[model samples]
Target chain A: MRIHVQNPAGTSAFSFTRAQWDAAVKRHPDMRDLEVTIDNSDDGWSAALPVADIVLTWVDIVGAKLRGCDLSHAAPRLKLLSCNSAGVDRLAPFDWLPRDIALLNNSGIHADKAGEFGLMALLMLHNNMPAHIRSQHAQRWAPMHATTLKGRTLVIVGLGAIGGGVARLAKMLGMTIVGVRNGSAPHEYCDEVVSVSDIHKTLVRAEDLVLACPLTKDTRNLLSRERIALLPRGARVINIGRGQLWDQDAVCDALDSGHLQYAFTDVAWSEPVEEGHRLWATPGLILTPHIAADDRDRYNDITLDILFENIRAHAAGRPLPNQIDPVRGY
Target chain B: MRIHVQNPAGTSAFSFTRAQWDAAVKRHPDMRDLEVTIDNSDDGWSAALPVADIVLTWVDIVGAKLRGCDLSHAAPRLKLLSCNSAGVDRLAPFDWLPRDIALLNNSGIHADKAGEFGLMALLMLHNNMPAHIRSQHAQRWAPMHATTLKGRTLVIVGLGAIGGGVARLAKMLGMTIVGVRNGSAPHEYCDEVVSVSDIHKTLVRAEDLVLACPLTKDTRNLLSRERIALLPRGARVINIGRGQLWDQDAVCDALDSGHLQYAFTDVAWSEPVEEGHRLWATPGLILTPHIAADDRDRYNDITLDILFENIRAHAAGRPLPNQIDPVRGY
Candidate 1:
């Protein structure tokens, strides 16, 4: 068996030394019988197609290009494609893949980091910290009365790994957690769980709404203008997931009108948003370049461990963990 | 049991509606409860002072005008003198006529309001919310990374009512609470408690330090230039107490040098701080006009209740609930 690994530049995993790689291989004795090819090139499509039994690819790679490549002429043995990401929207319309090939994702790996970002955003809005910082800089003692989250309601739009982590953290801070997911079943961390179809009705009860869902056909632009308006005045919104899940223009309008107290987004529709974007000027808006899941050391180690475990399971003819359901498009 | 309440406005308690005046009388059932004299005129002071069993006078009357007023002449009848404030610095130097006059304060009344303010200030510094709000107003997607308090250390100065409240709330949010007070007594909410003598040494461990001590001779300029330098870099300071507790120049310099991330202050050496003060333009400083304890409806009610409770205790010869020892000044 042989494995191929590909990742973006500056990722520390690319610098894993020979001794460390040897130790990792020793820990996974099954990999001793396998051949591994570490490919760090833009032309990974042509380079990795040959001799690779398993492929580990970065999230940014264009899935269509990988599928169109003539893999049978190169790496005919490829049986699995593992994504170093939680979402698989970019890999959509994936029906063209060989039927025997399996897809797995790095889903739970980013939970802690993303949940940390979401909690920070909520605290920022509730305390009106930004206004205080500006006043501090100006040496002005302009104190304002800030709201407390002690008895507030938090509505999590998804109950996946990241959202579950957020719910647990928020609950510890004395907040009431209300979760909305596609499934009808209630989550353990949420005080109330409603189907995604009742999201608008649930909005009225949420004091702070957090979006932590993947971008699927059913979830794209899920927070439409009408739904955004349904949120009570002074409600806050935090998005640590895909930016396309919300109607950005409507969010900006709500923030501008002071109807929504604040909104924070780590993921944007466009990377490196243009200078004149309306979101830049919206009142009570916090924007961060998509870095919600950024624990470099830990994330790299976790990604590698997940990949190694999946490979071992595959060789034993056992079920692969984190296997993506093609129908669900998770 | 005739009590005399002296306010600068010189309006008698009788000037209020019958219901309001009766409420005050009901709290002190032991009092003969004669009509409350206005005492606005200097002449009324001489007559009212002699016969009064209890005195609730304004701080202004106890200041420089002490030379002209003959307080000792009326001291024989006075059993209690309750100050309607947390600070008694002005009353400290005065030599009361007798040791029996109990000095009480409205301490616990302001804890919730002030603690809420400190929490808000800490959140502001950690989240960098104001910068985001400004960028949002400018319509620019200025992306920046923010710190979180989830795993940070919070150092609280003065583990009394206000500081204790802050510790309780921060502890609930998963923060490690370290406290400094006059004594080294163990505190229930604090993970570690240190004496004021060890504050400089403890500063190194604090990521967020809150000033909640009263302004006193010993604590004046406690956070001096030399001591401010001892704090961990990027540590934030939230002062909900007296401004004199911190060295303004040193704090400004730390913020300007980017060593101190932010400062939030509700109290200043001067009220309605004049324009052109250095603090007004200091980066990372939040200036609030000392309204931390200003929950309009709750404020008056809480303070009045404290006074009423003390008056009742005084009339029955019971120990006052919030008595302040003049020597310690808290």
Candidate 2:
């Protein structure tokens, strides 16, 4: 059984010490006879692999690197494709791969960090931090009444790992957690769960809405102008998921008109946003370079743990954890 | 027994209907009659008998009114003085008044509202809400990292009613709550309590500090420049109490220098702070026009409850609740 490791650009995984690699190798004794190959080239997957059983891939940047691979040509011996990312959208469209090839994802890796960011967004809006900062700079004490989360409603757009983490924390803070997902199912942390179809109606009642869904064909531009307009005045929003899921122009217009009191986003349609973006000039807006899930060490450690556990399960011929369904696009 | 109601500036209590006053008088059978009088006139105290059993005074604007009256002349009749406000600063320097006069105040009236404001300030600083609002108006999706409260430390400067309320809520959110008061007594909601002498050391370890202490002669400018400098960089501060406890120039300098991340203040040293105040130009500072305890209906109800309860206790020859020690100036 041979293990093939494909490294992504800018990943620090390449700097792993030989001693660490040996320790990891020793943990998997069943694969002691395995020949490991570290490939970091465009033609890394071009050669036919008749004996390769497991493929470990760490791709952070979305685009051609992971998706451009021709998986159909060498699907026979590929037992598993473990991705070091929570989102598998980049690999969703590939239906030509072997049916038996198990797909595992690092779902738990980013949950805590992303959830922390979500909580930050909720609290910042509730307290009106940005206005305070501006006031400090102006040496002006422009007093404003701010809202509190104790009796406010928080609507979570998705209830997966990241959203679930957020819901748990918000519930702990005495907030009413309302979750909106594709199906109507009871979630542990959510006080109420509504179907995605009723999202517009849900928005009207939510004091704060968190966008935590994946960017899929069904959810693309989910929070459009019509939907955003349904929210109550002074409602705050936080987007820690895909940016394309929201109608940027509508959000901007609502914010400018003071219809939506505040918005905190950690994801953008484009990375490293250009200068003079509308967000830069908008009042009551907080912008940061996309670094919400930037605890690289913790994320990598959790990802590796998940990968190791899955590998052990595979060796024992048991079902792997965090198995992703290509059709679901989670 | 008879009751004498004195209000220097004509209390809003006078707005109560005659029927309502009659109903209250009927409820307390120990009182034979009720006399409402404006205490602003020089001869106001002369009209009331020296043997009047109970006196209720409403003083909206603190200072002078309570001190100007010759309470010693009316001490024989004035068994109890029920004040309408929470702070007894205006009634301080009470040595000149009758030593036996029992003074009761409405201390817990603003608990919930002020607590909510403190929570709002914490959320705003943690989530950077104002920046997000600004971003939304610009139609920009700027991603930023936010701090969460799950594992942060909160240091409360005062552990009185308002501080206690804030500590309770913060503890529920999984934060470590530290309190600073005049003594080192253990607090119910706080994990640790330190004396005022240890405040500088305590500030160094706090991630978020709330100033809820009353402004007394000893507490004036309690958070001096040297003390503010002891705080860790990025520490957030919220002042729901009198702002005189914090040196405005020190806070402004700290915020401008990025030594302190944020400050939320509901009360300032001066009301309607002058246009060129340093607080107006400081960055990451939130100013609210001292309205944290402004839930009109709730405030009125609490005040009435305190007054009614104190009156009942006084009529029954019981010790009054919330008795203020003028020397301490609580």
Candidate 3:
């Protein structure tokens, strides 16, 4: 299979290093037969995309690359467009993707980085960092009280790879874990399990909350104003999922009204979140520019693992891991 | 034996609740033969400080309860003064403590809480929380890159209970651990163990540095300006040990000069670091109000365990655990 590497998002600075390229090519002997072509921002895609049997892409490049070039002329052998990200939302803007092409995300692999970021958000809020920052800037030597995770309740929405990673770390910190998701199978890290419909009950008891669920038509604005109100006052909220999964107004109001201690989001509806967006200055909101998962140090290695797995599976005509259901839009 | 409880810290606020007190007193049927007396801040110490055979105290209460009352008349039966804190530094003011009295510190018990706080401080700095705070107040949508613990080198200056906890968590986060201590015995959490004399060599390669070592005359000002200079530029320092262990001027200068990224300290030379102290206003210093080990929810429970063990051992003419060496001054 011929694979074309595309960096349409213009992150040439972070393109796969020579070692990463070597690792992927040498990962398995079978990969030796696969022809790979690399592309950069300076190079025009005059011929690469149209002839690629499989397009290896970045999360942010899908829409830009697709919009800038015509992919209808893609080689008939092009069966997949593999992404190097946990979430596939960045690919949504490219509506012209061929129906025959399977969309595979690097789901479980980047979970480590994403999950670590989620854990960071929890620690930041629990430590009352906002207050500390203010004190530091004002040169105030204040020893603010920090509430530890020991014996406190943590509620995780979504039982995916990311959520599982967060659960494991939270458990180590001595938190009691309550999980909410569609599946009912027992999750070892969770002390208690609840269905998606019962998230309200979970939120009421949650001192620290995490949202790692995929966004779909069924889950848009899952954390609505009323549902957010269901959470105990002073609860902390962290979003490692799509930004649209939370109602911005509800989150801002909660922080402003002091119903929520703080809200940290790694994803936003707008990539850079326009210059003066309300979330930027919201009292208890911390707007990080959507780089949590992408900032991972082992990002390329993890993405390569996913790519290798799917490649081997495809060769055997077996089911591909992390193949997204386009209609459901994960 | 008679046990007198003195809470001049008046953590009547933090004291055992009705149920907690009941549970402790009723913990063992053998306690029925023992006598226990409780004293609050309001209670006059006219007799409380004199007649107690075994005194159970909080670290903060030592100075407060000892200074105003005369201890020269302590009962002939007075045998032990057990503290519910890991450090007996607060007892420094009581130079006249009877040489015959065995002083016991709750050393390893709160290691869990203090270590967790140490881990918290690490996560905060590595996540670039300070920059995020700046962006939040400026209402800017800037996503700063943050370094992760994955594959980074961490040097632990002590390998005690608290250091061990921090090491375990750091390992889970993918850091390589280097330990320096007086003991040459291999520590499980450290990948490389070095003697006290090798600290400067360890500091040169450390990306993250931690001090969980005890402070004595030999260890004071351990992080002197020259030693701090040996650390790789931009190294982060965390002090969960006595405040005097670090040279305040050295740390402040390092942060201001951009040689160190940040320093987080739970202990200051003075509790409630005096207002306007240089440390209070140091650019990258976080002055936590000395509650790392003190806020532990298990404080009283751990204290009780020590008391019970000592009581049983003392009655049998056996040596008590956690007995402090007056010469070593732990």
Candidate 4:
């Protein structure tokens, strides 16, 4: 089988170096027997696509005009379009994807990274790290004591790979997890599982709220102004999912009004938040520029692992675990 | 039996309220049979200590003159002196205590709180939160990605109550715990246990270093300038122990030089950190005002639990579990 690996042009966070590829090959020796080609230029894609049976890429390769390449006529043998990202929300509407080629995402690869980040976010919010950080900026020596998170309730929305990661770590930390998802399926990590329709009841008792779902039509602005108000006073908020998962303004207002004690969000409504954005100076707000889940050093390794696993499954006529359901738009 | 509970004169972190005392009594029902008197004044101590069989205090009641009251001459029935703290280094030298009196400390109560805080600090350091906070102060949207804590080496000094607490949590987070305490006895949570004398060997491999030992003659300035330099480049330092346990100036210098990636210190050489202290403006440094372990909401209740547990042990023939070894100064 022939495989084509297309990296994004210029310097990107997910850009893989040649050394990384070599290291990954050493880790997954099965790649040695395959015909592989790697490039970043559009010309390279034009050349490699025609002979490629499998293609691995970051989502940027797919756009309205398919990066101005005619993949339908060029890549006849392509059986897999593997994306090196957990969320493929930006690449919705599978009309551009050839029906013959299956799309697989790098989802479960982020579990360990998300789990650690989620726990850290929860602990930071509980211990008032954001406020303490603000105090440090002003050279203030204020000590705000906090209780342990032993019995605190967490209402985590979306029990997918990312949310499940947070749930596992949070449960281990002695928190009572209330998972909110599309269906009321019982989860191993959550103490109680409630559907999205029953989120209000869980919100009323939520001491901590985590957003770790995909940015689907139903999930956008899920935590609106009213829902923010429903959370008990001093509740902490964490958004590791897409920023559109909650109302950013409502979060800021709740934090400003002291209804929410603190908020830690890795994502923003807009990438690279412009100068003078209110979020930059918002009190009790820790804005981490969308770097919560990706472990830069191991991201490519894990992505390659996913790709290899899917390739093996495809070869064996088994269902690919990371394959995206086109109808779900995940 | 008469139990005198002398609280600090003003509002203190560990000061127990009347409601708290009543709550403690409710939790430990055996206390109902005893005559318990709670007071916060010099006059109250003068009247109560003379006839008291046990004393519960926040370590302020014992001075050179024993709070200007003679405990040996008046309090002949005093059998147990329980301090509402884990470390009794400040009250070292057992000359003031009568030979018949056994000193008990609130040690294990801090495990849960310390575990949470320790895990938070490590995560913050690993994720470069100190630098992120600095960027947040400048309203910069710089994203620094980090690897997970799994398989990372943690050289934790002092595997006592606080350090042990940190170890259990760190171990759960997939870190390799190398505990450094007074003895070389292996601990359950630590992958390897080393004595204080062999700390230099561990420092070279330490990706993260934690100071959680007591401030005794042997431990004062334990993490000296040379010791700090022994750590690998970009190593993170967390001091949740006493202020005197590590060299603060060395930590600041290392942070400034970029030899250390970040440092999260809850204690300082002299705290309330004073106006114009260099630590206030140090880059890549997070200085919290020494509120690391104490869960203020449950501190008094836990202290009462310790007191009751000790009281029960004293009633029986068994030795008080929290009783201090005078030679150890903790």
Candidate 5:
């Protein structure tokens, strides 16, 4: 079976080089036995698409209008499409995806990086690092005090790979975790589990709130202004999920008013935030420019590892762990 | 037993109020059985010190020329001096402390807070949060990449209560810990233990270096300019120990030259840093204004708990857990 790797242009961190592919192949030598093709430019896709049995591409290249790149038209032999992102939120309502092809996401690949970032964000928020950062920049000697994370309540929305990773680290640090997800299934890291409908009542208990669920019809604006008011004063919010998952203006307002002590958002309402945006200088807020989970050096390797594992499972007629459930739109 | 509690003015976080004393007494009701007298002024110390068998005061109260406050002459009845600080480096040589008096330093009280702060500083350094803070302050959307800390090497100097706390958390995060202390005794959290003499050679292996040793004649300027040069390029430095332990100028220069990726120093060469100090605006450096380990709310409770435990041990003719060894100066 032939696998075509699409190198999309203009994606800096996600753009994997040929050397990275070689390095990944060194880790998974069994891939050397299979037929693999790569393309760097727009024209290369026209040649690579028709005969490829599998496509390992970034999520950005999925709905692109490149010549002969349409999966339903030119890619007649395509059986699998592996995306390099944990959240396939953008490709939701997978109407563009052909019925015959199975989709796989790089889910667990980001867990390690996300988990570390999540832990860092939680600690930073708890310890009032954002205010200290502001004081440092202002050439002030103001000192803020903080309590320990132990015995504090953490209400995490979404018990998927990213939230679960955060929960595990928080649990190890001796925090009481209350997990909110689409379902009420208990998670090992969470002391208590509640469904999305119960989130309104759960917010009052959240000393630290983490948004890690996928953005979908049910999740968009999950933490609205009304919901933001439900959280206890001096609470912290960390968003490793999509930007649309929260009401950005409400977050900024809460931070400005000191209702929310601190908030760390790796994402923003819009990429490349506009000048004079409130988020740029919101008090007690830290903007990470959406670099939380993506590991620069190991992204390609982990993505390929997931792809290879999926390939092995596919050959053995077993289920793919990273396979997406289209009906759920994640 | 007569116990004098000296509450010094102007010590914001460390100053325990009467309400705090009552709260602590609620935690340890047995303390109420003893004759505990609190003095909040210079005159009060003079009155309480003369008749006191035990003195509980801030480290700042030591060596003060207050009338009837001299442990050597005015307070002849004193047998135990319980200080609120973990490090009694200032009261070294025991010249002022009566030879008959056994001193206790609040060591384990700060362990939990110090451990949490150390972990936060470590994560911040590894993830390059200093750079991100700069970017945010400048209203720039620059994105920097970072690797996970799971496999990194952390070399910590002064593996006492504070250092051991950092080690425990770092070990939980899966980093290899190399501890440098006065002795080579194996630490449960440390993968390897070495004496302070081997620190120069061990600095090369450190991706993260922590200064948690006590300030002493032997530990002064431990991480000097030459030793700082020995660290691997891009290594992060965390100074939770005394400011005198490291050559602050050398750290600033390393950060300026990009030889060091990041450094977090809660302690500074001179705190409430003078205007135009390089530490105020050192690139890739985060100056936290010396508030790393002190919990504002729980500080008194923990300190009182340690005092009560020490009192129990002292009454039982057992070795005091917090007693300071003057020969070591910590």
Candidate 6:
């Protein structure tokens, strides 16, 4: 199978090199018989796309590279599209996605890092660290109280890879973990799992809320103003999914009204979160420029593992891992 | 036995009410026959201390009540001194403390809250949240990469109430937990435990160092300039135990030289952490006036539990739950 990697957004990005591929096949003997050709590049990658059966691209380069490159005319043989991000919300704007193509995301690999990010966000909010930081900047000595994590209820939305990791951490800290997802959770990290329909019920009991689901039509703005109101006043939220999933204005209003204690996000509407935005001034809204779960070497290692596993699964004609439920958006 | 209640701190601190004492006696039954006298006041508590067999006081008001009060002459029969604080450093100034006096601190009461504070400190340092907050204030969108918490090593310098809780939380977050104290740890929350003699060896392996032991001769300046230098460059430090354990100036220098990634302290030598202090301007230093555990309800709950247990143990002539080592401090 011919694989063309679209290193689109300038500089280098996550890719499966020929050497890495050979090592993978060597490890996974089932794929030893299949021949593989890789054309990884940034500049003339579209030229090699026509002969490719699979394309390793990124979620961030849709507008810059994917939009300009005509997929049907250039990559007629392409049967699969593997995204670089663990979450595929970056593919939302790509309306021309081929229906016949298989889509896979580099998930689970980033779960450990993403879970740590979620935990950090929760800790910062619960401990009143943001207010402490503000006081530190002014050199003012005003200390605020922080609630304990033990025995507190954490409602995790979307009990997937990242959510599972977060649940395990919270559980270990003596927190009562409840998960919210499309259906039942197959894992055992959380104390209980509730359906999306019962999310409002779960929100009332949640001292901390984590949004870890993927972005899709159904999940976009899933946490609406009404749902946020369901979370009793002063509840903390950490969103590691996508910015569009939150109604930013509603969140800002909740924070302003003190209805929400803190809303920390690693995902935002815009990547850089430019100046003159209301979000910058939103009280209790801790803005992070989306650099959670980083460590390039580790990131590359996890991504390579996922890539290798997906390739072996595809070659063996087995159901692919982390294959997004186009219907659920994760 | 005559029990005179010493309520010398002006208002109610963490004291058992007459009704509470009655209930405690009823609950224990063994202490029901003791003659309990009411001397709950600041003005004349010293006069009643002479006849007291046991004195219940607080850590915050030790000096105001204990300094001019002649304990040896007034309370020759004193068998136990119960303090309403997790650590007994507040009791260090009294050189006249009778050698026979069994001192007890309301330890393990504030562990959950203090542990949460420690977690917050680590998260803020690891995620670089202070810089993000600074950028938010400046309306800048500068994003920086963060190191993950998993697989990192954490050295908890005290495996007591607060330190053990912190170790448990850190371990749950996927960190390798090593503990350091005057001697061996009694419980098993950490991956390993070492003595103070082996602290330097442990410091070299610690990515994060937490000072959770009390202030004492051996522990004061425990993370001295020499020991601070022993830590790996860019190591993070969190002080929830006492501020004097760290050489603040040395920590500031470490932060200035980029030798320490972050230093967050809930406790300082001085409580309000006065203005014009170098710590206010120190790079990567996150300071908060010591309010790690400020839930009055929880405080009272934990204190009452300790009071009941200690009273029962004292009446039954059993060893106290949190009898501090006069030499090792806590």
| Share of reference contacts found in each model | 0.34, 0.30, 0.42, 0.81, 0.76, 0.70
Per-model DockQ: 0.27, 0.24, 0.48, 0.81, 0.75, 0.59
Ranking by DockQ: 4, 5, 6, 3, 1, 2
Q: What TM-score would you give candidate 2 relative to the actual structure? A: 0.76
- Residue-by-residue lDDT tens digits, candidate 5, A3-42: 8888876556667678877887898887787787777777
TM-scores of all predicted structures: 0.77, 0.76, 0.92, 0.96, 0.96, 0.89
Q: Which candidate is the best by TM-score?
A: 4
Instruction: Give lDDT tens digits, candidate 3, residues A94-125.
Output: 36667777788878874666667777787777
Q: Which ten residues in a row have the lowest lDDT in candidate 3 chain B?
A: B9-18
Predictions: Cα RMSD each: 5.8, 5.9, 2.8, 1.9, 2.1, 3.3
Task: Give the per-residue Cα lDDT of candidate 4 at B185.
Answer: 97
Q: Write the per-residue lDDT of candidate 2 for residues B127-149, one digit (tens) a residue.
A: 66445444544456555445457
**Per-residue lDDT tens digits of candidate 1, residues B223-245?**
88998899998888888888889
lDDT of each: 0.73, 0.71, 0.76, 0.87, 0.86, 0.76
For model 1, residues A1-330, the per-residue Cα lDDT tens digits are 677776554554334444545677777776677666664565754676676788877756536446576656555887888888888888786675666778888888777666666766786676665555445545555656554465789999988888987897777667899999997698887899999998888999789999999888899999988999999998899998899999988898998898888888877788777788766645577676676655544565666677888877887899888777777788
lDDT of candidate 4 at residue B38, scale 0 to 100: 88
* Deviation in Å, model 2, residue A312 alpha carbon: 5.1
Kindly report which residue stretches of model 4 are placed more than 4 angstroms away from their true locations once superposed: A17-19, A22-31, A64-69, B64-69
Ordered by TM-score, highest first, the candidates read: 4, 5, 3, 6, 1, 2
- Enumerate residue pairs that collide in model 5: none
TM-score values for chain B across all models: 0.86, 0.84, 0.88, 0.95, 0.95, 0.88
TM-score of chain A of 3: 0.90
